[model samples]
Target chain A: DVKVTQSLRYLVKRTGEKVFLECVQDMDHENMFWYRQDPGLGLRLIYFSYDVKMKEKGDIPEGYSVSREKKERFSLILESASTNQTSMYLCASRSGGSYGYTFGSGTRLTVV
Target chain B: SQQGEEDPQALSIQEGENATMNCSYKTSINNLQWYRQNSGRGLVHLILIRSNEREKHSGRLRVTLDTSKKSSSLLITASRAADTASYFCATWANSGYALNFGKGTSLLVTP
Candidate 1:
């Protein structure tokens, strides 16, 4: 089956430390996204890349950045981790508007 | 910001019972989708209903959309213990390509 793979399942980072969450998809989809899920906020988009080297900021893009060096790999970076940024990070990939997204297992990050 | 809001944050039902969830969105949308996530796992797509279409079904799942009211409902017939999971509703608005998801409804199906 096709899949989206996240590099880490759980992470702990100190405040002010830079954190990286990696995602890779085997479906060769054109669109990849990173979203952070909090208890009451649902899933808020951080950043998304529709093509290699192209990125767009989403609703909650503050303190976050993204890289799409290749078609299959998309990465989310936390420039300076803060305690408020602690949440479950999810990565999703979609080919087009006709289909639903396939998401990675998610990375739960705790910033202390 | 989330576009959709799902009612009844949690639900508990016995096996073989029907479970229904409702979602309401703010703006014009191209489509509304339902997703299921097992504990600590990724979401799996359950169904999608477009703005123009009122109803759609896949196996035991039935979804209905009412664009006039900007709402949608998902009905899962015959719940099983394995059906215990969190269900989220996501909407793709006409102005954007990304989907805005709701906080989700946690359902517990007890055998």
Candidate 2:
């Protein structure tokens, strides 16, 4: 079975603190994504990377940035966490011919 | 922007009963997928129906797609308590790499 591992299941950070969420996939998938799931808003993409050292901004990438230093690892960075940034962060990965993405367990971040 | 919208924000049914949820999308898609999410877990992919396929089934799950209406339905027959979860529908939008997920329908099965 394919697995996506998220480094943190739950996190609490003070407002203005820098936050880092990490995701890793073992399937050798070429594509990786970071999204923030919010109530009523669904999953809004923050960033995605199709290859190591390459990243693309998604719809709601204003408060976020991403790093794909290695093929299996993708990281999401919150410059300065704020109350509004509190939400469940999801990571997904997909291969070239896969039907859909394989998702990580998710990281629920709370900014206070 | 989210492309899919699933109806019935919440549904409750007894075990062994069947539960159906509908999803509607706004634009053309290469394929549509169904996912199930437990209380605090990430979504698990359930089924996928491509643009050229009308219906597909896996175990007790049946999915139907209608391109003309831009709608799809998921039916879980003989539902169990373990099947109680949030169901979401996703589709590929203008961006070929990412998926646009719906708000989701929360289903509860009582034993």
Q: In candidate 2, residue A109 scores what lDDT?
A: 98
Residue-level lDDT tens digits of model 2 in B57-85: 99999999999999999999999999999
TM-score of chain B of each: 0.95, 0.98
lDDT of each: 0.91, 0.94
Best by lDDT: 2
Q: Give one digit per residue, the lDDT tens place, for model 1 in A42-85.
A: 89898888889989988889999999999999999999999999
lDDT of 2 by residue, A2-112 (tens): 899997999999999999999999999999999899888888989999899999889899989899999999999999999999999999999978868899999999998
Looking at model 1, give its docking quality level: high
lDDT over C-alpha atoms for residue A39 of model 2:
85
